[model samples]
Target: MTDQSPSEIALESRQAKAARLFSPSAARNRDAIGDLLAGLLPPSARVLEIGSGTGEHAVSVCQRRPDIGWQPSDPDAVSRASQNAWAAEMAPNMRPSLDLDLTRPGWDAGLGGFDALVCLNVIHIAPWAVAEAIAAASRTLIAGDDSLVYLYGPYLEGAATAPSNLDFDRSLKSRNAQWGVRARSDVEALFAAAGWAAPDRHEMPANNLSLVFRRRSPL
Candidate 1:
């Protein structure tokens, strides 16, 4: 495969910015996400954020945590373009957007490594394969046990599901058979297979959760 020249990628970014988008959920939750990230990320951590819709959180968090280098990525061209624009306008420690599709082969190639990987509100919106791909990529992109994988989204945990979350899950499934909120236990087991310990879950606003999973040492 041919690597794109910087000029080419920039041109695409300009064109795609016309497709710039906004998400109510991102606007509503960005501050909360930032608050959590401020506490979780170590000084000078290099972070890679997946599914960075509209790049809102990236701009918000990176501005506050200039100590961290943040790389934001999205599979969608529109989102990627918008991310570039956002970074250009108000980047503190934000890098240009990356073209990453977790489910695609070679997606994580050439990514040196990261101190932490963050994915917000993505899994339930995508197929199960994407979640599997996240774990698979961790082996190469995240180096050691102290590194973390942070996931934030709605999940089914404990014995009972909240009514609102159940409704949201039904709505997601209706939109696409492959998509719906996932079970926490199921997600934990999947990551364990990829050498991560069970996540420490934090309650967030709107019944969502922030799951912090530490990478397990490679044997």
Candidate 2:
């Protein structure tokens, strides 16, 4: 038997209800994202997914690839609760969502070893420093030539910028000056500075892209 405070019990109840929150976009984009991930990730890999909003993608991707161990994380408490609930219902391989903030210096603290890192529609929602932190952390966490880091979102890529993405970028900037679509060249430069190879860009169903990066050699 265990003892619990009234506040602890109340917190537990709130968390249970929180899990039901859903994201419509997560459902729409999951299948397409999974298909792309299937080709990029190894048959058996430990994958850490950052900014696991509503936990839908974590559950969906893990269900598709049972061999992959999935760690879902987000800084938001509500998102963490939602992820925990989804993991409980759908994914045996999914671990409890961790409190992760990319703006912090030691963002990767306490996370177990992982072969790959996945971030979906996150960089555009946060400041550029967040992306840089991810790059720096990936260099520290992932090792060897086979390690991978995959980023999925809309980006400004030279003259190839779609009109829709341009509009989206404008809307994002309007919301927060620091938040907007990042340049592919800028992202590649960060990865290069961290000693990772240049990213391979894959076009997705929406105007989004999947940027796959790996190390040329162990760092």
Q: Compare the candidates by TM-score and give the number of the best one.
A: 2
Which whole-number lDDT from 0 to 100 does residue 141 have in model 2? Answer: 74
Off by over 4 Å in 2: 1-18, 217-219
**Highest lDDT against the true fold, candidate:** 1
Per-model TM values vs. the true structure: 0.87, 0.87
Evaluated at residue 177, the lDDT of candidate 2 is: 86
Candidate 2 local Cα displacement, residue 166, angstroms: 0.9
Model 2 RMSD vs true structure: 6.6
Q: Residue by residue across 64-147, what tens digits does model 1's lDDT show?
A: 898889999987777888888788877758898898877666788789678888998888888888899888777778775578
lDDT of 2 by residue, 107-194 (tens): 6777657889899988988888889888887877765567799999899987999889999899988878888899899998999998
Poorest stretch of ten by lDDT in candidate 2: 5-14
* Residue 62 of model 2, lDDT score: 87
